[model samples]
Target: LEEETEIASWTENGGLFVGTNAERLAEYKRFAETGKYFGIESHVLSPSEVKEVHPLLRIDDIYGGVYSPGDGTIDPTSVCNAYAKASRKFGGGVYENVGVSGIEVEDYLTAGSAPGRRIKAVLTSCGKRIETPTVVNACGAWANEIAAMVGAQIPLKAMKHAMVLTEPIAGMHSGLPNVRDHDLSVYLKTQGDSMAIGGYEQNPEFWPDVDPGFAFGLFELDYDTFGQNLAGHMQRCPVIEETGIKSTVCGPESFTPDHKPLMGPHPGLRGLFHACGFNSMGLMLGGGVGRELTKWILTGSPEVDLFSFDCARFHPESVASSRWVRDRTHESYAKTYAIVFPHDEALAGRGSRKSALYDELKSRGSKEPLDYDLYGACAESGLAFWLVDQGAYEEGAWRLGEADHPDIPKHQSHEYLDLVEGELTFDWPASHATVAEECRAAREGVAIFDQSYFGKFYLSGPEADEAVQYLCGADIEGKRAGSVTYTPLCNSRGGVEADLTVTKLQDSAGSNYYYFAAGGNTATKDLAWIRKVLEDQNFKAQIEDQSEAMTLISVQGPSSRRLLQSLTHSDMSDESLPFSGAKHLEIAGHPLLVLRLTFVGELGFELHTPAESAVEVYRAVQEAGAKLSQLEGIPVRDAGYRAIDSLSAEKNLRHWHADLSNRDTPLEAGIGFTVLSKLKRTGS
Candidate 1:
């Protein structure tokens, strides 16, 4: 353009203002190096290459490095004028020297369930209150100060930096490309006709303290400490030495504790948005950040995944442990231009893989099915197991041993049993309500829960009851037809063996029955002993093991009563038979034991049916209660069976090994009258 110009002027040195950054060049190098450590498959310029590629002066410490041909520089004063002209042409608001005093924050709260909050406007120093539905705070280093007015902690801080510009040294290809590299932590190259060089190496601690009042005076450089650092860089990079000491400038950088930009809502504050704290990457990532910032102001999060920068995640506690994150962030301000990362997310450091349990659980369902809960467990089942296994035996023994139930294994290697305990100790009214709602669902309609491991027993032929009665030490002579007996089976040595429920059957013959025990494997093991005893006695009873053939599902809800009442043609109510009582009914050619036993304390019935019919029965019950609970809005009480069992035991409803035992005598165990007198007559 100078060749064709009639009037033209050229100056090697130009007025430059990073406005907010003086250049913490060393910090910029670190930030850039970390990215190399964990590299991105993108291109950036290197300092050594910058010296060699441009035919300016003698080069030194030259090595394979980052290069970008499109890099250039400018006079901030001229650029500001250009921007002002563009704004005037576009009719955009331009406020200079006028800073924001107070932001008039108004939240137009439309009452919601919890009232999701938002920000309405930001009033500036010009007494101009920008009225809008959404507000964005792009005040850079002062973001936190402004954000606090809107009820948000911005996780932002201010930093000062310095950059050096060398004297004019004309050479072929007069202006060399702007270059950046991390090897020596410096970016060196051109500034118009002069070598506009900079170093992010200003030792923040060694330099004279900067007065916050004189922030924009970039011409005031850190003369002493920065001079020493600049000398060393010039010694290594010969190009900077050829055109050394043009001028020095300083500016501020905004940062989050994590060294990343903060760009999101002001958390608890409604409609208030943020796009500040770029450290020094603001200009580099500006276009992307700006677009997202606008989107984020409208929506809580930008489409480009900005979760990492949301200030809410930092809170006041998380980053409190490490001061490095804060310090490093400040060091990498405008003057530094440091590589923001250390290792290649690919190569520089460590690597890991998922645990076996997590792999299995994740693959088991469409998504990870086992809910250990991130809020509560904060990890996978394996992680939980690790914590539990650490002091399992010791903690278990301490708490349970004090309660007199030493049956829990001791805190020894072999004795340490793996158990996942999640019940909260404190009371929650909502939890109780959930339990009641579950029970209510069961009673009114059908609710099928996990009873895959429920213990069951099957007995057949003429003398099944004889063997059962002898094994249980209970008299079945008066066990009413179609009735079930709550019997306490015992070991011959006289301790309560297992708590069993035996249902009676006539079947066109004399009375016969089988026992179903309470404890999971305990009942099965006890029944195994009964079969062995029958064989030892040479008894003619036939024992068919039915534990696997059946899975006892309790359809105990109000719906349970209605469905069973319709299925069996029998009415079940508190008046007809008490909670512990039972009845046999025929449903579509299948024989079922309908018992009024509820673990949840709900008014419901349990249908003891074959495992094959479980799905069918479950569907039928679910269908019956579909209109009652699962329909979503029906107001109903629920009783969580698990909670009921725990709470019931606490309330002393039915004892497991206690009331039905010979270990402490029936009276001591709390149930004495259930023992029959006829058993004394049959002493043989």
Candidate 2:
């Protein structure tokens, strides 16, 4: 942009991040290592070295710091003007002070004869109608409102952010680098002749109802909230105390639930795209975002892994609730500078969506003993389980053991207090032993897991098989009924778009259908990709989202067959339902589609049943397993996501969004076996 527009909107004064605590310093050291891996220039500085970079900082209390010479600040207003000028030079018209009143949408058929919605036009408040087939909703704080006009939704909310400016100090200059005291959630930079200080507070003020005409508007000085950071600012820069306060700037900034920007095409709409919800980093990420969005608009997909920022990542049900969006957004904003733990889960917006077994799972955490020996053992061991929102559905997590710290208060029903009081560290947690036992059960005896959060979908019609063969990297062609194929769906660049399993099934009428099971969090994203491919190819296939309609229960271990065989009349032999085979059977008097697949590298069966019957079926399985446990003297346990992670990691399994993503190809991910030899030879 700088070269094209010839605008000087950036200041390359470098940046410094200082830590006052050991933990923060350790975090900085790890970040420096990561920067090295990425070939980014960064230096871990000592107190004296940090003083050399910025003499104004009182580094006496600082433990350590990291300095990156490439880090700098951009003037947002100037950058926007430059982009507008560049757009005009490229023959694009720029409009300002115009508000979107409504969006006109119409039903249309794709090239493949599939039903879809397209933008017909956009109506503006200035009595002008723009005739366009695509509309990008880039209205930062008003993004949700604009989306609502088109019957779409994006999970974003605007919150008030404040920054204070001090009268010029004698030694302050433009050359001083931008400095951040992340431990104190405060940042400082030189703004011309003065110093500007800003912070992220624990409790931020939300603007639920932003005025329609509040563009580029500032709110009155929030002294109460802005004052909280003044002490930290003074301690870091002692000269700030002597200088008089110049002015305070407070404005609304849009934030998302996970603190990542909302980008990519809307899943339900054909031509509607999202490029907002930057969480106060718009100025820094704007250029990159603009480039990626442009590429996506022209080519149907972005060039890199953007699933983390995809607007479809959140379940519609969770984002539809204003209360849930507000709570999660608040949590995301507060943790802007907090240390990120690998295993940490959000505490807000719990139970937004739940499986049929949600209540039963919560009951297992109770202190009161039930009829089952498992419950009795849990009570004795002070084991308390908690559920986390996975793909919006409440999935069970590791059970907590007795609190390592006795001073922590205990709840009457469960031990959530332990989670609140226990310090989160990089080392093993108190629940490690409990998770080990669960893993043991899965490896030895028997373990049942409620995996209802898996995203389920169906593709049917005469062209279903053709679509699958084209989209999947595996050789799924000519696969017989009851065959399950684990495949990687790749993009045009051969990057893994999704890692999932596709099972071929036949209806009573002999029509073929395909069942797709994907990671819970990537359900919407995967669906969007499938629909896009189908439409682009003009394939005569119909896609259905059954994620919320079906529930998945997994039974694994060496004794799994014996335990399941005792409950049903269907054949449980390997010859009848071999590995990678799927069949519809009557299990515990309920009809279920069972697949012989294992993510934990064990003999396992995944039973996909109707969501309404999941609780009863799960209870029956638990009861039968308990009876078998008593007879065989082998433990039968209920496992959670943590145990699943441990067992899968033991087998070196790759998890989506963690070990595998859209940025990696199957060959690079060590899963080249899934790709067809023909495609590899042809370099397709």
Candidate 3:
């Protein structure tokens, strides 16, 4: 683990983020709110001050800069050497020229009869057999191979990254702050008497495999391939073109699918942990990562929510495909310096994990063309889910609409509506069916909507009920089977981690299960959290992520019951299937699990149908509702989420991550009804 850069320097003086365009610079200033919220001292720097900080810059080309005085650079070699010396002084063993060959494990059942894997011993290359109860896979580039030894898959790949050191140039200040121009995709810092330059090129070269012999060795430098970054460096600092190249340093660095590092316990294997895949950010994040990981290792959970860096954030599908991992890793590396706006989907390594209806929906042209550049600024202010400025008419901008009383704009937001002839149409089929018209249809007439993107999951096994009760804020155990309990999955601090709906599907002797549903964006966050809890607590339960396995269609409005009664033989009365009640029945021979719950504050039923029969059931409901609406002389229309949001807002309902986030408690968010104090879920 002894590795280092040649230079030995440490400074807390932050650097400058220079940009040429004023709009881009303003976008960066808005993005810096994240740092400001964290209590970091950051400010927008003027062109003149930028020269005062780093005088070598070409000031005319730069428009503005963001300077953070608390952030700075350090030499990793010095830190590692200091740690190594201190560890050896404390009688810690240091093995050189040796590596772990394989890991041995013993499988056993817990007291709850849940299976567990414990590390038994480790075999090293130096012919050493050591007994150990734990293993930390800190192998940087070879982390995946080490994880494979224990049958654990780590979605990490090695990407070949290169850097160039300049031959000590005149007027080079040894203490000059590091400069990062993300637009140019380049970074520059002082290395001894010379300047070090590196960047993330769009077409980064990644190693297909990580050979043991490749460790601590540089790859053959490809100047032609390096020219892209070289050009960027020249653009950032014209002086770099005058200084002669001293040497090129090219080596393999571990990268994860996301730019964030992997830092938690291995999802599949017990007694094994991963702290690699720094994505070339190891040196900067090492100290903080070490402190947090140490707390996690000792207490079974870290104080902070590391969902972004969790190793299990990725699934087996991602790990099974090396090519996909390579491509995603390359994207992560390349975008290391690129602006990642809200709702910006990665263009690489998609479709590896998709729903059964992915092709059907895609072929039907259900995609919404998102303009990230236009929406990114608003998104930075925690309003990503809200419609951007252009969507003011689609989802009425109440602040502006109420204040100015401007003329109503055309409704152009149809992101969540039913596909018309298998295509998403922003405009209504009929001029009378506007957004306001749809809102009225939902309040008076019956409306059917698509809820296919709901994050669905099923928890099954003997301990299912107890496991959920332990994790939820509401009293789920007291709820009867076939009843839905809306609750929040709280962190240890009793902050809302996720707001979800859970139904006790079965509670009979020797059989127990629960069905859970959350927002689509929380598929990974919620699942990874429950799995981590199950693993740590040795819960005898299995979690099934049915997010894409089932398609959800919702029916709401005053006449929804009558419309559904005409199609299904099941009881539709409030006395039989009351609110929060669930029933398993059939519609048009398609099996369905119906939950009588409403997000739009109305009499609604969410029908969960098998993905294969979703289309059939949807068509049956549509046709039946249409007939009922025509006979009743009321409009029967399909509505989108925008209508639902307006309705929910009118009813004072809370939206997770918007009004209710991990930072707030249920009571604080004015949703104390969703929580039961009997559960004793308050954070002390």
Candidate 4:
């Protein structure tokens, strides 16, 4: 912009982030850590140093600040003009006062007899057809509508942001440093002799409809809604209240679900690309964004991990509902200057996907699907809890106040740490609802846990046994009907693919059958891997995913048999249904497939039932347990995954994915005893 002369109005003034509260100051420290990670030079300054960095900021309420010395402000209008001039200079067409009416994509028949969708041309509102091999959708706020024309879902939400330019003030020059007071959620910069202040209010206005007519235009002044932010700005810089009224400019900026810009090609369609959803950071990142897009278009990939900004990262539910986008966009905008820690999930727009027993679980204080239900339930009885996200699982467990679990590993990988969603903890509860008490109940009494999310599959056909034997490291032929065995699916290199329990079922007319159960977190990967392996081996076995249809409720501990026996007419003795035995029976008038196995090293049975009957069976088990507790003094309680992990660790059980993964073999995982030498598998 400086050298071109065609758009030389752009001048640079540095930017500063100042904090006025301890929480926000800590946020600056975290930002400093992030800056170091990203190789950005940033310094955390004291209150006195903050004044020296920016004299305009009030340091009385200020705890500290982060100063990005190289950060600067720019005039976006001049930058855009410069970019357009440069594009034209480079022989690129620049269409002004024009809009895209539609995008035309043609499907080409492929060798596999499937059709490939390819962009053919762009239909413009000016009655022009731009025929090109490739098209870039850089429609800014209207990018979503353009993407929708091509049947692509883009989770972009436009929010109305307002800024006011104060009347010219004495001593305020044109080259003052741009300042951001994060605690107040306001920013201030010099506009000639005047000042420009803007805020990202907690509650933001969503502009979901951004048609062509609304393009490059500002919304009318919303003094009523903007007053909250104005108050915050005036409080940060009290001097701003004295300045006379000036121009109030309100415009819309597009935001993605994760607050990062979408600057790559659409994961689905061919010959199409996206560079919109800047989350209001377009002006600062425009040049780099252009370079990134250019590199991606030319070379087919970018260097950095753009998963956070991937346009395809969103699920259909996230983009299909305007309210979801609006709620999340508001969260992103509201926390514009707030520090978000790792694995911090957005609280808005939750539970879009629910299980069959969602209402029953919710009635039991389930705030979320799997992660929060136990904690919320424990809270009802006055329990103190700590939640552990992906990174801090091991450490967070130790940090639990007065933690009583002595078996929690300090050095090795903990399987509970493998949880993608954060794990709930009732450790050191203020009441009797502690994790220690839960473990005790599972060991000395009876404990039940919702294990309905386990990955399940049914394999049948005449070659089912042979097919399973070829893929599993264990001997599948030896597993007789009504029996189960814990085994690992291994690669040719003898590395474990997954640890699961395979149960041999009664053969039907010339076909053998088996039921497989794997860990919940690895459900999708396990299913896909199994299907691929079966396809590669050319097995004639029929496999079906029963994960969503089936539910597994685990009732374990010494009194588990009695609790279950109370609800069933079947024999409960070990002689009748031995350990590792599988039985098809009825509980509370509902059909169920029960497998005797234990992850917690205690006597346990996994009652597998249909989704429709899950709630009834669970309530029956609860009632049976309550009656058992009253008569036999052996109480039955719901146990969280934490207790399960603790008990598993005490029994030296290796957790799938965490303790044993594709890197570990059956022998290396200390489970070679489970692998029989009679039938040789691929890994053997």
Write down the TM-score of every candidate.
0.42, 0.91, 0.79, 0.62
TM-score-best of 2 and 3: 2
C-alpha lDDT of all candidate models, in order: 0.48, 0.79, 0.71, 0.70
Candidates 1 and 3: which is better by TM-score?
A: 3
lDDT string for model 4 (56-140, tens) is 6677877887887666667877887888888878888777888888889987643322334778999988899989757888877
Regions more than 4 Å wrong, model 3: 1-9, 86-93, 110-118, 359-457, 460-467, 489-499, 507-512, 518-548, 554-566, 598-603, 624-673, 679-684
The per-residue C-alpha lDDT of model 3 at residue 519 equals: 65
Best by TM-score: 2
**Candidate 4 residue pairs in backbone clash:** none
Q: Write the per-residue lDDT of candidate 1 for residues 115-226, one digit (tens) a residue.
A: 2345556666778887765667777766656776765565566666567767766562444555444334555555556655555553442122324354355536756646
- What is the overall TM-score of model 2 with all chains considered together? 0.91
RMSD of 4: 11.2
- The clash count of every prediction, one per candidate, is 70, 1, 0, 0
C-alpha root-mean-square deviation, candidate 3: 9.4
RMSD of model 1, in Å? 27.9
